[model samples]
Target chain A: MSTTDNTESLVQLHNAGLREQGRWRVRGISLRVRAGEIVTLIGPNGSGKSTTAKLALGLLTPSEGRAERRPGLRVGYVPQALAIDAAMPMSVDRFMRLSNRLDENTLVEALESTGVANLRHEPVTALSGGQYQRVLIARAIAREPDLLVLDEPVQGVDLPGEAALYQLIADIRRERGCGVLMISHDLHVVMAATDQVVCLNGHVCCHGAPRAVAEDPAYQALYGKLSPALAVYTHHHDHEHLPDGSVRQIDNNASPGCGHDHG
Target chain B: MDDFFVRALLAAGGIALVAAPLGCFIVWRRMAYFGDTLAHSSLLGVALSLAADVPLIPAVFTVSLAVALTLVVLQRREWVSTDALLGLLSHASLAIGLVVFALLERPSAYLAEMLLGDILTVSQRDIVLIFSVALAVAVVLLLAWRPLIAMTVNHDLAEAEGQNPVLAHVLLVVMMAAVIAVAIQIVGVLLITAMLIIPAVTARRFAARPETMVLFAVGFAVLATQVGLWGSLQWDTPSGPSIVVASLAVFLVSLAVSRGRHA
Candidate 1:
């Protein structure tokens, strides 16, 4: 919401609802994504985070409400699930080309930005989980899309690498000034860099600044013992965020993060 | 070669040229059962044709397309599991078609050929229809190859990237129905899925990219047709089953080689 300007939103879900299996998977969700900002969706499993993302992507039609995107919105998506067939052999360079017919230089730059440039010729299926996730991120970044939507992008990544990836997302946002919409269960990463957070439980439970959502009771109820970690993060000013994302407070002399909220 | 052999080769060549690329998608999407369901329902088209005194190809294409649309609708509802839904429609249509055929008074001798295939006896009209469908499917694939690959990688990603994944999916199923309707004559309905999957599955082993895999699959199909035709000629066996068997044999060999090295 606190994006740089009053530019038209890249994508919007205006009271979107998708119903199936005798219930609404996601309902009455309204959101707007603008350039140069990050908006994250967080919730328990089946809270319809992915469903809402699918709606915004136009992969699924809204049953009741409307979902819309800016005309000719160029989007890049990084999915949580490794949706590509495991049996199929594909290299990172090939995967990038499959996404968009980018020139070799663009493909290399994408890989370089994601720190997987060396693995361009490596078989994507054979890459380790962490490596493959980075490869997927590279593929998404290759398109130079106006909006980047990531669903659980930290999947298959180590705890340390998770924060780095989030930081990289921040870097990408800064460099491209593209609107970013992401889904995450990790509150630490969500609290750190996101401009806004939407906590969902089959509907928008609470949404606003990360600090407000962190303090929200609905968010508290869904994610029990979440506030303490946020408090620890806030309380620790001088400590470096560890590879595991825990920080040690200077005045209080206590380890602020217990790693409970880390994804 | 004799006239019959030339006709068979032309039919097989047309099928191989178009089918191999589409088959790669069928394998990637794991829609083998869906393809089978459409192929099996072609018998319903035949039954409808016979009962109404209509043309077989048009009747079969219509019924197969109808079955595909029905599957898409049922899939949206999720009233039944996908495999269960496929099994239900597949057998139900086949049973209905058989019942319809039984009610008629003709085809005491041709029933066996119908159940399998009489590719050797295909007339010029049949070849024309086959080639036309192949050409149409090929053009659709050519225009759609990028979007199709993106959608296969991740539907939400593809949609967000402005690729229209829903349109891609609809187009895929329509093309699939057409393939089934045409291929049902070269291989029986029962063996149609075999033709769609076996070569793609085999190609995955030797090729490191999707386009290459498709080309390899085409090569495999051509080889299967050639070897099967030669074997059928030498042993006086059924042509369709021989082709299916030849392709299956190649797949099994690839699987063995892949496992032996990797294991």
Candidate 2:
């Protein structure tokens, strides 16, 4: 809690809860994201991961406690899934400019950064699953937001693509120095890059450093045997595959170390 | 062309130009049924206009807007599924309109004219009204274009990125209500949604960007109006139905062309 001083905190939730239709979707949730930090939310379905994300993004006001954002904070978000109807013809280039008007250089740079520059003019409907996810991320970062919130950033991708995506997210944090809040169900893949993991089952079951949460009994009960696998994934990945098919060694000193407190 | 035909063409063209962009969002959001609901409610607007002896356009706009807002509120409640709620409102309004028409002792021919619009009977004043509303709608759409597209792509993404998706949604609904109110004179309650949907879907085959799709939709809609009006004059057919049929023909041809390209 005392970590709130030095770094600029982007969004903070204090015992925040959302009530819908006489039911508390999530309750007693406390979370924070600071500049250049990554916080991931891991939970099963109907556990209010999305609702919690919404509250943090100020999309939904908490019915009980409070959610606050830095004044004039610019945000970039990638939702869990975006099914662009075939009836709405949209190209990757246009989709990137959906919320803001970016100059040609900024647009191309964002696409290039995500390694989807080749697909800039391609129809969004024609993209492969991995390609679409990259384009979504590219679109979000093009705004150069103060905070980036991604909901299940790798929903339908293959295993290799999921790891690559997590790596890409980590790289984005390194480059942009923006705060990141991610929601993921893939604990094994997401835990590698996540600094903090809040495990939720209708509420915050356990939350701490990824390794700490992975060993928590509550997290083990919720995720069962998956926690051990997550521990191994978090412990062993000293390197990651970049989007350009290049392998990059993780610099423990510079990069957000795998579940280790930089403090 | 006779004066009446000119007025009809001008009015229909204005409505088409505005409706096409809104229709793209409708198609993207898969709100064809929502459009149908609003169109159906326009019948009740007609009834109210008749009952109160007030101006038709404002009455229709008011009723449609009210119905749209009610739908928004009801959706938040989640007591009933969205499709069921749509069906309930759609049929309820239509039945009420019919009953009210009967209670007023209006002739069946008048009711028939309302159901199957008499575009050739549009007055100069009606043309003025249509253009005014169309201009207003065009301005709002231009201003709201990015947010609307962003929301359609993903509502949560739009909201999290500091864009006002709810405001964008409300603005879109209001514009739709305005278009439906003005369009009721040309296409009537029964066929108004056709003007909003057919051209947008047709435009989907060729467009590679959202803006291109909107442009293509406008072109298709205007072309349909012209072709439909000409065909009606040549064959003594119902003008509104002729326009819808023309748009349907365009859509079918686009489908064939797109299928052939893929093959």
Candidate 3:
């Protein structure tokens, strides 16, 4: 939590909650995003990550809390699933011009930045998933919004593609200084790329930097049981330690029979 | 041109012009069933109009608006899937309208006209009414085009852009209600939805962009209306169903052409 400066965040939610069908979908959630920051919400299935993002976007009003935006702040959003029909018949260029009109130069630049400029005239549904996602990102970035909200942006991308997309997003932030809030289920690659992590399961479980949350029992319970094969950010953890903070390599003073640390 | 043909042309042309733009969004949003439900509810509007001795257009618009609003509200509940909710509304409203038809004593043609349509028998007042509503729907759609497209692309994304999806939805459904109101005179409740969906679907085959799709849909609808009217004169068939059949033929041809290209 980077001592959230109220005036800097383009959008913020305060103790927000959404109640539907007499049940709380998510509750008591608070978030703040400032310029050039990337906030990623991560959790397992039905973890309220999307719900929280929606609340912050004011797509779902809170039954208990409030979501606020700086007046006249422009934001661009990439939703979890667009769900547009295949029959809608939209070209990538047309989709980019939906909310805001862009000059040819800007349009080409945005599409080029995302590496999809060649696809501007193609039907949107004809594009592959990776291309489709890149188009969506380019559309959002083209508008020069103050904040960009992306929900589960890398759902259908391969591992390398996901990394490349994250890199592209980081470039956008560096170039435009737009705040970003995105949702994802991936634990490793996302943790390394994002500045803040909000782990949620019905409610916020833990939120902070990736390194701090690695050893968190709540986060570990949710993700640690899985093998390290999925971990993209490797750190040196060859040495084990007890909960009491003692190095567990065979203490030669006490474990002579053990082959451990037998200098 | 004969006055009768001229009036039919004006009414049908007006409806086609308006339907093209709205239908594009409907197809984009995959709201065919939703459109059907709204069309079915127009019967309730007509029934209410006759039962209450209220004016036809306002009553129809009101009831359709009511149904659209109800759908929007129910969607928020999430207890019922959108498809299921539309199913319930479609059949229920149809049944209720049929009941109204049975109980009320209007001209024998009234029921048939409401169920199918009677563009050939439209009066000057009806023509004026049709054009007025069509113009309104077109204007509203033009004004809301940006927000509507954004919402159709992704609801949360629109909200994150500081747009209210509910507001966009309300505007869209209201425009739909207007089209339904105007179209009920030319195509009746049963075929009203066809007018809203068919042209757009047919245009999908060749249109590479959304706006081009809208333009193509309008052109197709105009051509379908002319062919259907001419066919009706040649074969002494119902003008409205003939129009629908013409559009269906176009859709079939589009399918074949697109399939051949893909193959």
Candidate 4:
């Protein structure tokens, strides 16, 4: 909602929906991701968070409505998990180069940015859950995409590690100025960085600026007591803890920081 | 070596060189059954070739490609489970091929040769055709390697990153058909999947990277071919089945060694 009107929109889904096997998977979803903006989709199991992400990425065609993207848009995507076959041995370095041919500098810089440079030669199957997720992010960012779509990017990490990963994502957005469309079930972790939150369950339930969506009665009804934690976290986290144990102060003056009372 | 022996080596080695890398994709995608389905359909290609008086390799490639496309269309339609559909297609094609062979009134000796390859009788022309197709396949695989690997690692990620998962998938199917068409001469319809799977599985034990796995697979495949040919010369066993047995032996050894390392 804070994105300037002149910012280019990387992807847009207009009343988009997909039908599978005589049933609608997700319907009536409309959203836009503009350059340097972050939009998050949050929903419960089987609520079509991944479906919406796929629809936005044009990986899945909308059965009913429309999904559009800028011509020749470059996307960097981190899926929930890659189910790599045990029979296929793949090192992190090879995985990084899977989608595009990156120069040595770009490849190394991406890995270093994600703090997975040490894992370059490590077999992907041998990586722990968190390390693998970071490697996936590294692979995504290596392409220097115009849009970044991350589906459950923090699925396997511990709480502290999840925070660090989120910080890393924020940093990437800040540095690259690319539009981000993310899917998450962890409302509290995502709400702080998300400009807009679209809560979905087969359809968009409520969508607005993150704080407004978190406080919406529909979102509260769907998520129960989790809404309070989201509000509190967003209000308190004005500085981010980087992965290397450094603190970076977010520019709270540029954006509203709990200027209105929650109670 | 005798002229016939040399021709056999060239023909089988050419097929092995291409089959090994494509076989790794088949294994990584868990499409061994799909490969089996394509191999089974190659019998239909043979029957058609015999009945229509067309060239064998082209007919086999056409039929296998058709079958692969049909499988994709049927899978999208979602009529039955993938495994069940594969089984149905595999046996139906084989039975139809047998019926066609019977109707054509081919001698059982010729049919036997087709079913269990007569690699020892490989001619200069056959060797030439084998290598031609092999070279073309290898070139395409090299060019498409990154996209194919991206699709294998994760379909949505590949698509999101502008890799064109569908195009990569179609390329893979076409390459698999090409390999199957040539491989049938060395391994036969009954054992072609073994030629395409066993070496890749064997390679999985020692490889830490995808390309390394592919290289290891090619090495194992060539070793299996040579060992099987030597065994055939010594004991007068069938070459196709002998090659499969040799590769199976290698796979078993790898399985044991990997398990030993872990234990």
Candidate whose DockQ is highest? 4
Off by over 4 Å in 4: A225-263, B249-263
Indicate the DockQ of the complex predicted as candidate 2.
0.73
Candidates' chain B TM-scores in the order shown: 0.93, 0.96, 0.92, 0.95
- Model 3: interface root-mean-square deviation in Å: 1.8
Ten-residue stretch with the least lDDT total in model 1 chain A:
A250-259
Decide which is better by lDDT, 1 or 4. 4
Steric clash pairs (candidate 3): none
lDDT of 2 by residue, A1-263 (tens): 11233678899999999998889999999888988888989887888999999999888899999999999999998877678778777788888888888999999988987778999889888999888888888888889988999988776677876777788888888887888999987555775676677889889988766656655778767766546665455434422312222212222322343333322
DockQ of each: 0.62, 0.73, 0.61, 0.76
lDDT, residue B226, candidate 1: 73
lDDT of 1 by residue, A61-176 (tens): 89988987888888888877765687566777878877568988888888887778999888887788888888888878888888888988878789788888888888888888
Each prediction's whole-model lDDT (CA): 0.78, 0.83, 0.78, 0.83
TM, every model: 0.86, 0.88, 0.84, 0.89
Model 2 chain B lowest lDDT segment of ten:
B112-121
Q: Give the TM-score of candidate 4.
A: 0.89
- Model 4: per-residue Cα lDDT over A1-263, one tens digit each: 33756678899999999999889999999888988888899887899999999998888899999999999999998887577877778888888888778899999998997788998998888888988888888888888988989988877778887888788887778888999999988566775677767889899988766656655677777766445665455435422312222211222221343232221
Q: In model 4, what lDDT does residue A98 have?
A: 85
RMSD (Cα, Å) of candidate 3? 7.4
